[model samples]
Target: MSDVQVRGARLEDEAAIREIADQEMAAQEALDPRFGFRPDASGRYSVYLRERIRDLDSVVFVAEVGGAVVGVAIGTIRKQESLFELRRFGYISDLMVKPAARRLGVGRALYDRLLTWFRGLGVRVARMHVAARSDEARAFWKSVGAEPWLTESWVDVPAADGPPDPAGSEAKPAPKRAAGGYAGDLPDDDPSPAGMADASDDDTDTDDDTDTDAGDEATAGEPTSTRGADE
Candidate 1:
């Protein structure tokens, strides 16, 4: 990560950003279709994310090695009356590091940049989503202090072949479990309002309620033509 700079993406960065995204997407598709990029929504997705970046309310951070874009993290501030009610929130929508950049802490650096930016913006909660079955992702998030709290179900369907999942028993929120879905709330930060939010990340380590892969979607604004995977 030496010489790597973390900075806010610019409209002029579209090509480089897209290149990183495309590279990340290729890796994702190869790793899991649920986490891959949408080939069809290429034009629109780029435009949408760039718009978010331009708005300032949203943030997009990246790590570059000697000028080669290696990683990116994207998210925004959102307000809603949902369970995790808050006057404001910093929502992470996407995060990725190029294959060559893995294990270099590029992901962590980008995460911190986005996190510090969010904290400065009054974002009280940090969240991301991962496949229930993706052990590596699970481990990664856990290692970073993100713990799992929900068992996602697609269709909300009737009892099928799977065992009747132990009813509401699991919905119980973690008491000592911090708010990042795992760790406790940030020091001096409001805990109740933050606790109510079940924020989660997509392939980007972002918000909780959006369309992810695995039939079970994460939470966030709909970015059409965008293919993504999260729990």
Candidate 2:
């Protein structure tokens, strides 16, 4: 077993971090073609990491064995407000373990340190989005005691035939169905919506947007680049 040590990431770790991120992205693309992730040709992922390392609300940690970084985990604490209450939770935005170092506890070490950090900040729950097709990730999270609480689905709406006029009349709202109507279940004949060519469902939650100084944006499913680390 490798003697893995986890610590906060530094500026010097950018190169290795980018390499791992690129590999993760490649694996994601293979798993789902619709995963829309593209790093610039000039290695823009490093720039992205640089910003992340500087964010106060975000935490980035790297796992090292024998003085070489083998894995990374990034997370952020975000405040959420609803009509009932306001609370904060931790979101694991990105995690990657080099192919050779995986299954050697590097990824787990990274995650453990991240969870510790989250707890230190009074975060009670940590959330992450795994790719829908990544069985490895699903099993890993389940083993770690994470449960699936929601499913995210997407549908693309085609553009209108003509541009909207500035003085156009307001659109009417769809009719509201009465409560407890129609057996409260979908019909078995046609489960899909009319005129919709494709619909996709992703159960895992991942952040696809770039990390900002304020905090990381929360996304619904894991992007292709970060899927490999879930193993």
Candidate 3:
């Protein structure tokens, strides 16, 4: 077994951190059509990842192979409803490792460290999302006791019928649903509104959470792209 280390990510690790997120997004996009995450041309994803690194309520774990980050597990210590009040749930935003690094415990080690971090924060539950059809990822989560807490679905509202004006076509989104899974569970009531999770994660838990598959097998390794559930 190789000597791998796991610890909190530093801001200086932004470039390497973003690279892992980007690569993981690429893998997810290839499998999950609903969660198709696409990176901008900037090759810089810290606009989305920076806050996690600095969050007192969040944890970002990095696994280094030969001193370079090869896997990541970024999550928040959230107070998800129905679970508990002041719940310290580790909502794993992303987890990825290079194909060459697969099955080397890089991921398992990272998970162990972050899990310890969450437990230290007094977290009652932990959450993560997986593609609906990724065998490798499903097995990985299963092996680590990460259950499928929710089932996710999505829709495609065709753009308005009109001339496809270059740099002019806009995709009008649907209104909010009060009982939806992801989109339904947002804490808009909080003074700190997160602007209703980015359009990318149409699967937000804005209201209530229903994770029927919480501990079920996660086959999120399909060959397609997917956006976030909501916020």
Candidate 4:
């Protein structure tokens, strides 16, 4: 890792970042069809990376070895709900390192740099999501002191014929879990109300209802593409 260089992502790094993201999305899509990326996802994500690179509230870090980009980590500051004690936190949007770079410090290097940026902004906590089925991802995050919580559930849109009967597609609950579903509070009659999903039975993590200890490290989100297997 002594040779690994972690720095802020540059506009020129967009192609490299998108390449990694493409691979990540493709892998996740194979794990579950719901994780599919749009055919034009690469172009759209490039636009997003450009915006994030220039946005004061966001940070994108890239890791390089011998002048080659090997990894990337992206994050943004988010306002917590008015009901929460903490007002703002850093949300890790994506973490990816090429498969060949696994087990190196690249992922952690990118993560730590992004984390420093968050702390500089006075962000008190950091959060992200890992697919429930990605044992390697979960293990990598846990190795870095992230605790797992909340199962994010997804259901196909019920036919719009009636009041939206979701019972047919409801996901089974993970054992012993109490909280976590979609993040927002939708009305009871809301057609798109989210339901709890068990990680044991789920592949993607989308949204969750969570309570964090100040400055804790963690994981939760939609399926992450290529997390470094630093464990």
RMSD of each: 11.5, 11.9, 9.4, 8.6
Q: Where does candidate 3 stray beyond 4 Å?
A: 39-44, 81-88, 156-231
Order of the predicted models by TM-score, top scorer first: 4, 2, 3, 1
lDDT of 3: 0.46
lDDT of 1 by residue, 139-167 (tens): 33444455444444445445556566567
lDDT of 1: 0.47
For model 2, how does the per-residue alpha-carbon lDDT over 39-147 read when each residue is reduced to its tens digit?
4621656765787699998878888889988777777776654432526666666666676776677666666676778878887666655555666555444444555
**TM-score of model 3 relative to the true fold?**
0.66
Report lDDT (CA) for all predictions.
Answer: 0.47, 0.54, 0.46, 0.57
Q: What is the lDDT of residue 193 in candidate 4?
A: 8
The better candidate by TM-score, 1 or 4, is 4
* Cα-based lDDT at residue 77, candidate 4: 74
The runs of at least 3 residues in candidate 1 whose Cα sits more than 4 Å from the true structure, single-residue gaps closed, are 30-38, 82-85, 156-231
After aligning candidate 3 to the native by TM-score, how far in Å is the CA of 18 from where it should be? Answer: 1.8
lDDT of 4 at 37: 61
Find the 10 residues in a row with the least total lDDT in model 3: 218-227
Model 4 RMSD in Å is 8.6
* Strongest candidate by TM-score: 4
